[model samples]
Target: MSKKWSIAALVLYVVYAVGMYFYIFHGASGGVPATLKGTVADPQTFMTERELYLSDDYSKIRNFLFFVVTPFEWLVYFLILFMGISRVFEKWADTKWRLFKNGAYLFLLNLFTTIVFYPIDIYRYSLSKEYGISTQGFSSWMRDYVIDFWVNFGTTLLIVLVLYWLIQKSAKKWWLYAWLLTIPFAIFMMYLQPVVIDPLYNEFTPLKDKELEAKILSLADQADIPSDHVFEVDMSEKTNALNAYVTGIGGNSRIVLWDTTLNNLTDEEILFIMAHEMGHYVEKHIYIGIALYLLSMLVGLWLISKIMPWMVSKFGRVLNIEKVSDIRSLPLFLVLASFLLFISNPISNTVSRYQETRSDEYAMELTGDAEAAVSTFQNLAKAGLSEVNPPWLVKIFRYTHPPMLERINTIARYTDKNEVETEQQAE
Candidate 1:
């Protein structure tokens, strides 16, 4: 067999074995059947890892579509459309939309792009619904999209203006200045996202289950995280997928759990997941991610500063752009940014997977309940319809967390070691 496919088969076998162990254990113990718990509430049940993870033809097809669609979105739809628009408006390039031709083009560019690409977005959402992941209605999805569009509209407008302003002021070292400015600007945006922007999409409230809240807070306390920052978001409106995340920076930072996760998981499982999230805050991964991204942007902007001038000389007239900052140059600017983003994906994902694996260990250490860690991941894999082992390319390019099989194995190893140590102490 080919190496990649062989590796895929081996990992998939691991997933099946682990899943079978859980199914048999739960069945024998009379632990809550997934159906009774409303965990896998659909009529089409997943009984084994092959069924639960590997055998989902819909998800695999959709994922493959994503591998195709993303580059199309970035390189084709986003790029070619803008290029076409600029050429179409060739005469008006300098004078037609004179007032709106500068920084305002950022907003117009995004609006046009989103409109052209909105079908792709909706098709993706539709696929999620078909696969039983999304619970959102079409109208509700559109409403959220509108809110997202305006948010982007505002941010893109500001980013383009500042970028251009830097370009005009310092022709030679503008990229360096902009790169430095991006660090603060990026952090400032992160600080605002949880507070100002997230509220528009979903409702957030202090977790109402007091006993559960206290347990979560205790874990936070153990981790030296502030108790008040843990909030539960109403995610059941939009999705059935389980998740928790830490967002914002400094005082604005908060830990958020999807209500879907709360409703689906046991309290013990929930605690382990929350502790894992707390580890992110404890480790300051958000800051680390921001720093890494800004560092990449520094390199990306510098490269653009070098290459953009040359592109302008070649395609300037066709693109209705005179220089790097012409606002009309936004598409080409994104071309460079997107290329950098594509290459950086694996690097960033590798760093994230390391942090995630460490956080898994941290949670195991904090809770010392290996069973809960195992169960937590098992249920999460089921909840999200995650392929416990995707193909090799997907693992490197797509996943930010280690596969479910690897995570379960990691916890089992730690669990086994702990038991051995206890037995030694007893002797």
Candidate 2:
């Protein structure tokens, strides 16, 4: 209903198109390699081959569908549906949630919106299943999905209430105050993510293999991180993908490996992976990442402050809204936020990619094992079904880690053990 919202949406779509064109043709990561020096190995083995592998025709289709088609569908079809549900159901002209308070209305609106998004989500999950990327059963996935929806609904409703209250209180300066508040709230959420949120779906325990745990602890010791224990999550119960990462903040932080990672990868490969995870802390990427994102989000909220009043002015009367403080106009605000998020994706992904690059370098330097790094990626690609040199379009939007070929090449370049040893000896 708002042309201001429509304009923001148009800009997002146009940028997406341009991004696709440039990414596919020019690529985001510069210096495209002429060839991959390594060999392709069987998916079951952690061994490397002399030849490199590319996405097969099937994989290309999967990539296209996942990265391009899915988002495009979200933009064109689901977004409209999403906004319509928000606009219509937000009023609650039909029913009530027990007491039927404003929070209750917000809950229905949010729940409806999430429900509208679910079919598309299920379809995407189906796509993942088809590609052998997900082993989650339909029932189990739906149960998790429902749990996530309720958790998010409560949190979002509270935030929406706070935001509108702020809007009412300040009228013109609410965005500034909200931005100030967001910094700590976001950090708190990050601090709680591993402890409060992650355990809901996955069960975590101390890493069972003492030899491997000791190796990990030794790596942590070398990194000067006081991590006493390494953790393993039973991810094999849900999906076949392999991963290991560091999470939480302060004393709650843990280095977590998926059971699948332990089962599928050798100690050497897992060590390389653990080193990569530890690199984030060693290089202070966690703090840096949060700072970068917080700044980006601050800028975004500033933009929202500038744009929202314009949206209110353009459609205030038509949408039956008199001012920016009206909770009824939250749907329009959310649409604008979605557009901003779309526009920010590339920038955010670029920052993440750069940090990942730093971690990869640190891992290679710390582990002093080029063979392990290379094989680590090879084994991971096998488990995750990641393509070497994923299409540039997919790479720009979807990849958080550097491409397999690029990382392999970087690791391969770290062949001089003397350099690593020299650095370690100095340390």
Q: Write the per-residue lDDT of candidate 1 for residues 1-427, one digit (tens) a residue.
A: 2234335545655565455444333322212335334333221333464554433555466556645555555554233433456444333434555345554555556666787888878888988887778999999999999998888888877777777778878878999988888877887888899989999999999888889988988888989887574789999999988998878877887878899999999999999998898878778887788878888888888888888898778756654567765555667778778877877788988999999998998899899888788777777767677766555556677789997767876787788899899999999
Count the clashes in each prediction: 0, 5
Q: Least accurate stretch of 10 residues (summed lDDT) in model 1? A: 24-33
lDDT of each: 0.73, 0.72
In model 1, the clashing pairs are: none
Inter-residue clash pairs, candidate 2: 38-50, 38-51, 39-49, 39-50, 39-51
Which regions of candidate 1 deviate over 4 angstroms? 1-55, 77-84, 87-100, 314-322, 424-427
Clash number for candidate 1: 0
Task: List candidate 2 stretches off by more than 4 Å.
Answer: 1-33, 37-87, 93-101, 317-321, 416-427
- Model 2 lDDT at residue 139: 91
Question: After aligning candidate 1 to the native by TM-score, how far in Å is the CA of 221 from where it should be?
Answer: 1.3
Q: How well does candidate 2 match the true structure in TM-score terms? A: 0.82
Clashes of 2: 5
